[model samples]
Target chain A: MLTGQLIAAVTTRGSGASRVIERDLLVTRNNLMVFVSGFVEPVFYLFAIDVGLGRLVGDVTGPDGGPVSYAAFAAPALLAASAMNGAVYESTFGIFFKMRWGKLYDAMLATPLTPTDVALGEIGWSQLRGLAYACAFMTVMVVMGLVASPWAVLAIPAAILMGFAFGAVGMAVATFMRSWVDLDMVNLALLPLFLFSATFYPLDVYPRSLQMLTQLSPLYHGVALIRSLTLGTIGPGLLLHVAFLAAMAVVGGIVASRRLHEQLLP
Target chain B: MVARGLTKRFGELTAVDAIDFDVHTGEVFGFLGPNGAGKTSTMRMIGAVSPLTGGTLQVLDRDPATDGAEIRARLGVVPQENTVDEELSVTDNLYIYGRYFGMPRAQVRRRIPELLEFAQLTDRADDKVTVLSGGMKRRLVIARALINTPSMVLLDEPTTGLDPQARHLVWDRLHELTRQGVTLLLTTHYMDEAEQLCDRLVVMSDATIVAEGSPRELIATYAGREVLEVRFPPGHRYAGWTGLDGIGSRREVLADRVIIYGDDAEQLTSAVTHSGVEVASMLVRRASLEDVFLRLTGRRLIE
Candidate 1:
């Protein structure tokens, strides 16, 4: 019976995702400029890190414990951070506006779509946009010769997993927000994760106790996964990062879907 | 659609008390009441979005509890608030709404122009919805509801805030849908709207149905054929005005006017005039659903 219910849930989620995609297609057709502008933020970060910060930081130790330029070390972490930023922006700000102000999900619920469908569909759209940004960032990395190994191709899927993890948790958090002012809490939580997830420097740069604390942030696992893949640092420890992200995606997705169902259905 | 002992509660507050009603295919059914009369709540239940706190509801022969999505698949809903996408153009709103029902893309494309023309919005098909007037938006919402060619449609206060011209435009489109044999269920506080559009209606007050029948039948049963309204001079107390006692079948002395309800207004007016009660002004008019509602609830419909 549980398996049957699970299958039904999956089917409705597919239906909901398709419905969202249809609406997104209409939005994209009308606002092509806004859709293209999303790629600009990460590119700006890349330029800032390569030109301004590269001169200050010089070469850093790569994931394989070898000397690599600051640009190459920072590039993959920026990709992971951009993935997190994209997913959180879409699932939190975008979903929150639609749920609270636009009342879009209210209309969708009046149809055959369930809250699970809405949650999955929104997360799917976020991942799609995140994937595009990741691909754009990776292309820039390739052009700049920042990608050091063929294993970097695997980072694309890693980026998607990172987006799923952040998107699910962001959506769950959005359900708790009451008004525009409540969004400050989201920024308060996310800015720290983005800044302190070892994105700007190696984990060793932090004190021993702070390094342990950094491991608890979801983005740290994402940053490490991408960094190792780009640096061709094949190690069994990479499995722990994958496992952490996978667990986050599953648990966060379930919590987000349940919370959305409660908020919207009620 | 059928509801048996239907009830909805928000914690300790009962929004809809136990009520029974059925909607037949190809007919316009209305729920008429003042604000907070459970009309929207009941409509939400029938739309298969709001869960029932008590009793049973069936839409399109399926229970809303487990078969909500199945029922919604064949049902259309025009929510009390406008849910039209402000960002999308007129045609895109209809197209995307149709897709929500899983309508094929080709079919939705083919249906857009017909819906636009039906809504009299062909001229504004490419314009964004935010640019449309209030009446245009109401019409577009109604058009979007019909995108799926639903078997039954639920409209919660379809013209609550529209001006007369817009309301009439919406009424005309709704009439067109009923003529095409689409079953429509709507809720409204406007007595004239109920009389103009609904073939049959139920009067709701305090979360319960007070009266139910065809509009004309409700008027005949509760208000009679004609009403005589007489306003005496200010401070002219008519507490002991036995003058109006034997003239009509029923009488209500409000602060502003004394209303006499009967089938023969002329005879009642003649009786009142001969009774020697000084009257500043008197008028007789055909009874309306407003009179029925007032008679049943002892309050004005619009107030």
Candidate 2:
């Protein structure tokens, strides 16, 4: 309920943001294949985990230090990684193209839609898409009997919160990018987060100081939160992860809208 | 719309410099200037899309700084570029833009067919916008701008790159708009376009308005009733006949031709010929807005 109020307050700057989402839906409806491709990468990784990696590794130590199947161990991390990857791509590539080549925002701002509307609408779209990816991945996890807890349902919202953080921050990063050359840096940033956020391994694999440093990665928080829920390791520590992602969302949203306002209005 | 010393600057460059103009209801006003005359900059300000660097601007009787979204809701803008949604079908472009104004879907749906008809893209309503011709695309943009039933519409070079037929089609549609009591503001480098549609206009140059009035008023003030054109052969130096000074109210000499502005072009022509000046060719024509523009800005082309 508090998260709902926070969203309502932040998005109340303009009423036209939903129109941006409506337009994106209109466009995406025609190109459904492109939309589905973003949700498939993590599913492929889940397939690998179930059919090949899980058999090789047998049971691994889960977030709760209990023996959990390798598929369950990696599924939640893949879910979190997918949320981050989907949002980062959607916000960065999608927004950069629309703003630069398409001149879409110029046309939008000519109407009643403010910069705040454009920013929030795009981030919200990414979040919803991330929600869909989360549900599908969770269903696969459940079908494979990886579900050890009913608390795993909370993973969908956690994935969406991850989406909000990564999407808004990715959008902020996109506003500062001038060309594809600058956008190449996004991969340089995300690849490290995906591989090193303890998605395929545990945090203790890194040196003590390195493990501490990895905790600073936003994706690490996402992995920790989703892994704990999917493994049924509920704890008070979960609030810290929720707060971190929420704070990132708010700060990223402000920066993205501010930068876009300057660029569009100036 | 009212503006008082409105200014817009980009870094060290002043795009619009201390210009003032008023747009009354139901009038087809125009801003005429070549490229870099700050016409688009002024239009963007009045459209409430860009903030002023200094000075005050009021659109729809409200300050643009504080009430831009409210002002923009009622102001239609057809930008110089046809910023249409190529991904969507013709009606979807109109529908989505109307939604941007917070209009209900049913209202937007009911309004789409009429707008497409006005833009004359009714037959192509179901097609993707990418398939439309240039003129059709331009019209679609104009139609999309009208989705909210804006009280005032801003068109930046609405027909800058169209062929003669397409230009006339746009002009006809704009004329029909004026008939419906919709106020229109347009910017163009073409004087014929301004003279054709503008109830009144301002000619801007180098980031400032140099002249403002009706076309006839400007021509009579700056150019005289008629002009006599005396063309000289290439590489020939202009021979200023002694009688040239007294033949017309004013005279302007260029590399290829000499122009004399006067009430009677025939009398001016006879006076120039009687002075024993061997002219390659000569013609008499009524003074036009082009003459007024040239007189005010200069004969040199502004890139």
Name the regions of candidate 2 deviating beyond 4 angstroms: A1-14, B238-247, B274-278, B300-303
lDDT of 1: 0.88
Model 1 regions more than 4 Å off: A1-8, A11-16, B232-247, B253-255, B267-280
Candidate 1 lDDT, tens digit per residue, A1-266? 53355468777568767788778767978898988778887789889989999989899988777899999998999899888888888888998899988889898888887776676677767777888888888999999899989999999999999998888788888889899999878888889999999998899999999999999999999999999999889789999999999888777777776687778876
Per-residue lDDT for B7-85 in model 1, tens only?
Answer: 9999899999999999898999999999999999999989888899989888899999999989998888898888888
Considering only chain A, what is the TM-score of each predicted structure? 0.94, 0.94
lDDT of 2 by residue, B1-303 (tens): 889899999999999999989999999999988899999999999998988998888888999999988999999999999999878999899999999999998999999989989999999999999888899999999999999999999999999889899999999999999999999999999878999999999999999999999988999999989999887656553465333666788877776678899999788988887977767889899898888888998863333
State candidate 2's TM-score.
Answer: 0.93
Q: Each model's RMSD to truth, in Å?
A: 2.4, 2.8
Highest TM-score against the true fold, candidate: 1
For candidate 2, write residues A18-76 as lDDT tens digits.
78888999998999998888778888988988999899999888877778899988999
Who wins the DockQ comparison? Answer: 2
